[model samples]
Target: MSADIEVVPSTNRKNAFRRRGLLAAAVAVAVLARVFMFDHQSLDYIAFIKRWYDFIAANGGFGALKHSFSDYNVPYLYLLAALTHTPIPVLAGVKIISVAFDLVLAFFVYRIVALRRPGGWLPPVAALVVLLLPTVATNSALWGQADAIYAAFSLGGIYFVLRRRPWLACVFFGLALAFKLQAVFVFPLLLVLALRKWLPWRALPVVPAVVLLLDVPALLAGAPLKQLLSIYVQQAGSYQALSLRAPSIYQFFPAGADAAVIRPIGVAVTGLVVLGLVAAVVLRRATLNPARIVLMATVSAILVPFLLPSMHERYFYLGEVLTVVAACYLPRRLWYVPVLVQGAVFPAYLDVLFPKGMGKGGQPGMIIGQAPPGGVATPPPGGGRGPVIMGGGPGTSMYEPTLEYRILAALMALAVISVLCTAWREFRRS
Candidate 1:
């Protein structure tokens, strides 16, 4: 009996060591992959980020915050200002910041998966899956966008909520909202928890409070208080299109239809859909569990962007990441959830990054460049119109949906339904 006990411990130790080695290997590979993508200059970088870096560098670094240089919120701009003083090349530095958060995102993915699948290989492997996921890597490393920052915080919020740490969850959610309005994609999930009274009402105020606290530095730097607070409001009004090639429900709209007439209907429908999901959560509150909450969050992340107006292609970044976590929670049934969501979102990235078409004979090359006389181009006041269309003629909107996008729209719709149904079944399970 003593020999048997010793043998079991030895075997468990060997398994644990093997898992750690595999996880280390995964992180090394993920980092190397991102290093290769570090040099690719995306259109958003050329048109917006590069100019903002220069403006921050030229205008007393942090002092530039006072001026409305970028449409992005103060939190990200603060990073740019700090980067101005660093020796690292601005392009690489920007991606590195996001890459750090990419790892943070993966860590949270691992933690969340471990909550249910503890001491197994699946959790470490799930972290690897998140790091290598095409959109996750490209959004930060290739595109140099900060989607990963808000995404990391949002995932932290979800993880904390699952741990029943409401205050921490609120703080993370607030940090996410401070970085990007897209963070609201997960807000519905948090709201559902609040309604169920699982998340305390006192903790709810922490979110906006964290956002406001993060804004103080920029406010002190001379950024107008009113304009600073209204960044998201301004962003919403800046775009006129119903959908920015986001593979959302708007894909069904007729070409050249008046956005003014269609926008309100889309908003109202989105509100109704959100309320319906919230109502479902309320009705099934008794069956709620960590796994069910994860699925509900997945539905919110995907369905909101899938239904809302004026969404960008990358708006579903949160959904794509959460699908991986949801699938990890119930691998047998939810494995295809990430597959479908990633499949739908990846092509949209290609549409902007390799707009020349990644088709049978298409060559991947720069589609367009709009640099100023001697420096990177600056986007017009609100923000640059969505990324450039390589071969499309004059007046072409980058958000224009193709047949492929329409097909992906169906896939995204299916994903949202799949997750919602899974949550419903979870509620029904004995």
Candidate 2:
């Protein structure tokens, strides 16, 4: 009897040690990811800090509250403006608030993953992947972008939807949308909930209602609704001079393609693609797994910007965050594709962050030369030649791949192929 008891105790001890080891490993991964991605001194973070400080100082305390609404519908600006009233430097306060949001997002990701896979390491592992994702880390921690905060609230809204808390979900979703319009991409998922009768159809109106409620403060501050409409119009009309080279129909065209021609075609094509994805989800609803549905919705969102004529690298934030969530739930092999795509964009970001020249015109290839760390030795504004314009002026341009651009394009192509194959297979099975 004594021997039997000893053996049982020994077995329990082994199990305990295994659990402890796994936990330690997870913590180590999280630590490494945080340190590598968010050192607080990174160039992206510093730039964001500077920008926030300048805005606050120029406007005077609470001044941003009045002016910020004109720029973006971001409700978080009010919170930041409030924080600026504190004795701490506005920039530092912004960073602290941002960091706090990051931690909260990480927690949500972990919790959601855990809910899906009890006692499995997938939750923590997913959180680690999210932390390590180059774009997410850079945007959230370094650039002080609100993508992380919005994504967290968005995911929380999804969680509430899953839990059958429709009202709460709508409120959170409203907040997420207020931060960034990209949050609308998840609307399809909510529709799924409504169709399935998991959420009351009546709850649907709450989303737009919440948005209007949040906008009331700005509306009262003499912020014309037309200004908000104009922002969307400007975004639609203007083309970004520089963008990550992702695989899209655009690649088929000659380099230096005219924005006038590209913009309309891009919009139409992207719209079709989004519609197709939505149809696929609706058609496969009977057989589709929750994970697959979420993944498809996310891929659709990511591809939309690429399909649109004028896309900035920052636009990828919406898709990248969702991809990270999808990766966590997906099989291991599927995860690597997004990981590769995420890494591919880093080179482009590096190019932008450490541009070859400053005073030079923002031309494409103009190598004004490198600037040293904190060195003002480079010619002051207007001294150097502008960015080198790649491709011949107007017609007769040949496309050449920069190492980073080529890699990014290739990775995006791979992602498209993988997703297509998976979707096709699932469709056939159904």
Candidate 3:
């Protein structure tokens, strides 16, 4: 009997360890898969990190870091500094940084979902689902952009604000701003919340504080204040086009549409939209619960991309994330929103990534300089405006508004309307 007891105890311990080991191995595989899977040596991989690495090599470490930037902000420069320290090739390091933030982004999505109703494995499951989301995967691993990095902070800021931790949320929002201007998609929501008294105005200074902290280092290290500020200013006119790969009403315009006309009108309309949202929140300040707040925030984030000029294919990234959060929060049939969004943007992503291999060339991450001056230099030949022409080959622009592209764009617009109308109805019922 004593011998049997000992054997049984040993077997149980072994099984426990085996389970733990297998779990660990699974995680390891996932990490490695992201790290090394799409290590295609592309030009962006060169411009983003390798070229920076070369600058560090030629200019002696951080000595030249201040003057080396094109349009990326200072927090990303800090990332570049840390990357320079690691011996892992600059390309892999860059992608790893984005991949790491991809997990952080998913975690924030989980928290957002869990805040509504915390019960069981829903949060973890949400995180995993977002982890494997197609855009999230491609942005970090395949395209190797830092969209997820700033996006994580932006999402965290929203989560904390919902949690009533305004200061921490502002810090995160600041980090998001310091990382990239795209965080603007979510920043205005905070402003609306503050104006509605959801957050204290005193908590707002953290935004500039965090921004100053990120910028001061470079400024002190010899980066010109004018040059640094001008980076964003220049971005406004960087591409004069009214639309890039973003499927929007801009798709209706002629190929060579004038952005001077579109930019001002888009700004006016975006202002009106934001004013309407702010008025709604302010007028209903009494009932502005988490549900209402999230709905408004989600709608605001989508509106910026949906209405803005010079928008890029990746611009809807925040919208996609917020839509997923809205779906979990509202838990209605939101497949339509994501399905339309991914459908509209996936072709553009393919064109950017596999331009030559697939014979479909579209815009790449020429973000800092990707905006066109006005209208496409080249529209689809003969301007076939039916639904979608089959041959959007190497020469065709993703912004060419093929028949299929227009159909997808229209679906995306309808989906946004559907989400907003549904949220409003639910808010009334609640």
Winning candidate number (TM-score): 1
lDDT of 1 by residue, 28-147 (tens): 889999999999998778877888899899999988899986789999999999999999999999999999999999999999999999887888889899999999999999999999
Q: What are the clashing pairs of model 1? A: none
lDDT per residue (tens digit) for residues 303-370 in model 3: 77878876877788888887777777777656457666777666766655554422135323222112
**Selected candidate, larger TM-score, 2 vs 3:** 3
What's the lDDT for residue 372 in model 3? 33
* TM-score, candidate number 1: 0.93
What does the lDDT read for residue 166 in candidate 2?
A: 84
Instruction: For residues 123-170, write the lDDT of model 2, one tens digit per residue.
Output: 766776776667766665455556777777887786676566789989
Segments of candidate 3 deviating more than 4 angstroms:
1-30, 47-49, 333-335, 356-398
* Cα lDDT listed for each candidate: 0.85, 0.59, 0.70
Candidate 1 weakest ten by summed lDDT = 358-367
* TM-score result, candidate 3: 0.82
Q: Rank all candidate structures by their TM-score, best first, as comma-separated numbers.
A: 1, 3, 2
